[model samples]
Target: MSPKILVVLSSHDKLGDTGKQTGWYLPEFAHPYYKLEGKADMTIISPKGGAAPLDPSSVEMFKEDAEASKFLKEKEALWTNTDKLSNYLGKADQYDGIFYVGGHGPMFDLATDSDSQQLIKEFYEAGKVTSAVCHGPAAFVNVKLSDGSYLVKDQEITAFTNTEEDQVGLSSAMPFMLETKLQENGAKIVKADQPWGVKVVQSGKGGKLITGQNPASAAGIGEAILAAL
Candidate 1:
């Protein structure tokens, strides 16, 4: 059977108080979608069940990249009207894995969303291939095991770092630094050698909690998830 993968995206569109638009980053979703296209069956979804917004800056930034550009032209439906995350609360077992795609939007919504927290807990407890990239790990912040421990606790993974957030000049606008929050949750983050470079990390526990550091690492994140699946 082709592995069924659930791709969760953030539905929030406002970027703090900057009057800027932000949601899922284009490459974060695009790169991974193409990588897994023939290998898995993907269902795109979000908290609100439709129109998961894209970060405008990300769209412009990746506009010149052929793969991202192609995705923008060809995959409108995937991000346009998504299935609601709440609809799959009890159906996680149907999926081989769950991927949380990110932008600044995830930091605001998915990070603290109760539904996201519960769903991630279900996937993690079931030993499914749970994964996220960049700010995507924000979704993991509140997922807890039956034992009441954070799923990410003591897990070695990576996400968009504090330095990277600061470099982007939105650190102050963020609720909290992702790296710091993950650390507080007991996640042992593995940093990339340089900023804006590809870096993917497999979780310390049997490599299930795969994560990537930034936009440049999205494709690597996809490759890693495919291998895990």
Candidate 2:
């Protein structure tokens, strides 16, 4: 049987108070999805279970990329029919890996979700590869490992950087910055020079923990998770 991988997405709806643009980006989820689809039985899940938002800006970024554009159009059903995190937490062991795709949405909802934290801890302790990209790593802040420490503690990982956040003008809107919090939790964070650069970091000899720098690295992140599996 093919390995099953849980792809966690955020259900956050608002980008900022203006509500101008918000949602998961096409490349962030679609690029990884296509890469993993052939290798694993992929399951997409979300915090609230249905209709995850998509950041409007993401659509513009991939407007010229055909594969990304196609995937974005077909993703409506998947987004609208996603399973709630609670539903998957009960059967966390059924999967071989867990991947979190990101946009600005994750910093708001995925960070504080108790179910998300529990599911991440369970999958990690069960020896499944745990991976995330961009702002997706924000969810790791609250995940407590079996050893009573943060899962990211002492782990080498990467995520959306403060510089990128500032460039996007979302620094003040975020509940907390990912890079600072990950470092505070003991992660050795590595980031790319630019947010759109492709960068993936696997912290530990076994490559058990993985994180990608931004949307451009989603394919690399997916490949890394597949390799670890």
TM-score of each: 0.98, 0.95
Candidate 2 residue pairs in clash (backbone atoms < 3 Å): 22-54, 22-55, 23-53, 23-54, 23-55
Which 10 successive residues of model 2 have the least lDDT summed?
A: 15-24
- lDDT accuracy of residue 63 in candidate 1: 90
**TM-score of decoy 2:** 0.95
Q: How many residue pairs clash in each candidate?
A: 0, 5
Per-residue error for 193 in candidate 1, Å, reads: 1.2
Residue 22 lDDT (model 1): 92
Winner by TM-score: 1
Per-candidate Cα lDDT values, in order, are: 0.91, 0.85
- What lDDT score goes with residue 184 in model 2? 91
RMSD of 1: 0.8
What's the true lDDT of residue 208 in model 1? 86
Q: Against the true structure, what is every candidate's RMSD?
A: 0.8, 1.5
